[model samples]
Target: MKLLVCIKQVPDLESRFKANAEGVWYNEADLAFRMNEYDEYAVEQSVQLREKLGEGTELTVLSIGPDRVVEAIKKALAMGCDTAVHVQDAAASGKDPWQIASIIAAYAKDKSFDIIFTGMQSQDRGSAQVGVTVAELLGFACTTTIVGFEYDNGTITAKRELEGGIKGIVRMKSPALVTCQLGLNIPRYPTLPNIMKAKKKEIIAIPVADLLREESLAATTSFHPPAKKGGGIVLEGDMADLVDKVIAILKDKTAVLR
Candidate 1:
């Protein structure tokens, strides 16, 4: 089976973040970059599938970003991916999701992969649309927030989480898209030995511009952080009094009542 896993380099969530003087975005110079945490689950799933299928299967990790993103791909290699492709260009710096989806879709279209997997959401933007968008672009059966998976006789059985504590079970053929959530599995940390092996793995660089047919998008606005919120005050009183006070506060602070 030829499996393609999509990964992204994102600012480490635990690191201290600060916007630059222009109040547009975070300072990149001192930021520690790592693979998006949810993507790690996707990679772990790929590794598990490879183990199930034995040595004949091939796994490819793909990501779009600047040249520095090779490290994120290498981390996947350390976890036992066979190879990686990095789509590099300055356009990756923009926050436009469609631009990213288009570039990934264009490259992935011709690959004819048996399966494609990605994280449920990107850490930086927290937008969970890429997997479905790419799947739509590729005309593949797609499932997001997948919690469990099983394969048999050229068909895939998947379990997806849904509202109201329900789980949806689906069956599809190969050449499908699955976006993983956090509970899928625990990602393994690469040992030093594996890291050494990963250093020798192939990391292919592809220019994003070459893959694109047009520069169809642009980001014209930026952002500044919201003001800090004040501490909450607790009130102790009888139930009727508390309800009246809560109603008054809600009426004053919001337009919820008729």
Candidate 2:
């Protein structure tokens, strides 16, 4: 069995954020980067599948981003992926989901992978479109937000989480894609030996320009922080008086009450 897991490097959420000078995305200076949390589960699940399927199973992880993404790829390699492919783009932040998915699909179009795994969404963009778009571009059966997975006899069964605490099950044959959600599996920390081994693993670097088929379909025209909220007002009084005050404030401040 051949498996490919797509991962991404994202800004650590706790880092402070400010718009770049171009006003297209966040400034990267002094920011810490890490692998997207959801992609960790995808990588772990792929590694587990490879382990269960035996030594002959070849697992390759892929990521598209600037050179810094090598850090993320190395983590995946240490987690048991056999090799990695890095699609390097210095301006990766400028690309939209469609462009990103197109590059991935182009790379995998001829790889003949039996299964492709990806996180349900990225932490930075959170568009939640790239995985399914790749599946569509490759003409593979696809399921998203899967929290449980099983494979046997050349078929995959997935448990998908739905709205209102509902769960949906899906079964598909080989040559499929799955976007993993949280609670799918616990990600393992890379051991010291594995980290050393990962340093020697193969990482094929390809320029993003070679894989890109066309220009980005969408562009960000404006990017800014949300408006600051005003200070809160506290009202302490009897229930009837509080209700009257609330109504008066609403009538004075908002068109809805008026």
Report lDDT per candidate.
0.86, 0.95
> What TM-score would every model get versus the actual structure?
0.84, 0.89
Per-residue CA lDDT of model 1 for 1-258, tens digit only, reads 889999998998887777656556667788889999989999999988987888778999999988878989999999989989999875475646667778888988888888898999998778798899889989999999988988775688999989887999999998899999888888999999999999999988888877776454556366556676868768997999999998999888889963
| lDDT of candidate 2 over 1-258, digit per residue (tens) | 789999999999988789999998999999999999999999999999999999789999999999999999999999999999999999989999999999999999999999999999999889999999999999999999999999997899999999998999999998999999998999999999999999999999999989999788888987787886868798997999999999999999999998
Error of 1 at 171 (Å): 1.4
**Model 2 pairs in collision:** none
TM-score of 2: 0.89
Clashing pairs in 1: none
Best-matching candidate per lDDT: 2
Question: Candidate 2 local accuracy as lDDT?
Answer: 0.95
